[model samples]
Target: MPAPSPLRAALLAARANLAPGLVLQGFAAAIVAGYYLAPPVRTALERLAVFRGEVGLPFAVVSTGIFGAVIPFVILRLSAATRNRYTLAQMSALVAFWAYKGVEISLFYALQARVFGEEQTVFTIVAKTLVDQFVYGPTLAAPLTWLVYAWVELRFDTRALIADLRAPGLYRERIFPLLVTSWSVWLPTVVIIYLLPTALQLPLQNIVCCFFTLLIIFMTRRPTGAV
Candidate 1:
């Protein structure tokens, strides 16, 4: 039998992931609601500084790492279809996430300060959205995500890595399709994230990353015939 077309495969993956996607959206909504309705939560979040020189960077790193690890683990554990003990691959991915998020948060502040002069306005937000979507998201963030996953899949074998890089249809069949599927989720999500204050952005991103990780795992694990 002929394999499903790429569009069909992407649609199937989206369908398979819809439940978790909705849960993630709802979780984000609840967080937004709580920030407004729950005074104490809002107060605490406000008190948490971001971009405060040395201290804030470490705080963002550790907090994002913890959330990145815990939230995905919980989601994976709760879903019978995904439940499994954490593997080395997952651990490696988590470490990658920790390091990436740390840098990302730092860059976010630096870029904003440099381009937008440390104060957010309509212009700054627009500038940030453009740079994030076009420059950072596609060039750096997306490729890094794929590379990390590919490394994990290849079991850190350097020889396999070189071969995979040279594999025919690697970008066409795998990376492009994954990018298309991912944009469906991340594009709007990042726009919303950029609209918020700097301190809130990484926290929200960490939450969304949990959903993204689970979605990737689910789609990759889909049976050959099922989708």
Candidate 2:
């Protein structure tokens, strides 16, 4: 049997993810709508930002870690299909990695706000979103995420990691599919995230990340009667 080309594999992955991606898109849109249309939603989000202001970056790190990694790990464990897929060590590693990512994203967003301007105008939001999804996401975040997952898949073995790095097209094959799915899912979502104030962008991202992770987890559930 022939293996799929990278492009073919990427497209297939994207196709499989289209349903969950749209659900995430809709869910984000609804949140934005509710934020504007419902006073309570706006008030609640503002309270979050105020508390973040009070407690500082540690709050962001912890909350992002919880939402971006820990909650997903817990939920995945609860799902019968994937319950046994990840070991405790891998889960701990994921938490640490995503906790770092939370800090990375916060700094990146701050940098974007400074470079691209913090105003929520269409031009500002579009520019920041483009730079985020294209430049930062592809160049920095996506590659690091790929590396982290690859290492985790290899069970934290250094020798195996070196061997895996030597494979031709390794980065392309591993990252291309991730890029495709990421652009599809997060491009619009980050635009939504950018529409909010700088203080709230990270919180919104944490929420969106949590929701998207759960979506992917459940989407991978086994069919009925599976062993």
* Highest lDDT against the true fold, candidate: 2
- In terms of TM-score, the best-performing candidate is 2
1-227: candidate 1 lDDT, tens digit per residue = 99887667777776666666667766776766667789987776676533333476676677666666666677677878657635646665766676567668666756765777545567776777777767776677766666666665555667866777788877666566566667666666665666556667677877787667666554444234431
RMSD each, Å = 3.9, 4.0
Clashing pairs in 1: none
TM-score of each: 0.77, 0.90
lDDT of 1 at 70: 62
After superposition, the stretches of candidate 2 with alpha carbons farther than 4 Å from their true spots are 211-227
lDDT of 2 at 184: 72
Candidate 2 — which pairs collide?
Answer: none
lDDT score for candidate 1 against the true structure:
0.66
Candidate 2 structure quality by residue, lDDT tens digits, 103-167: 88888889999998889899999899889988888788877777777677666877867876787
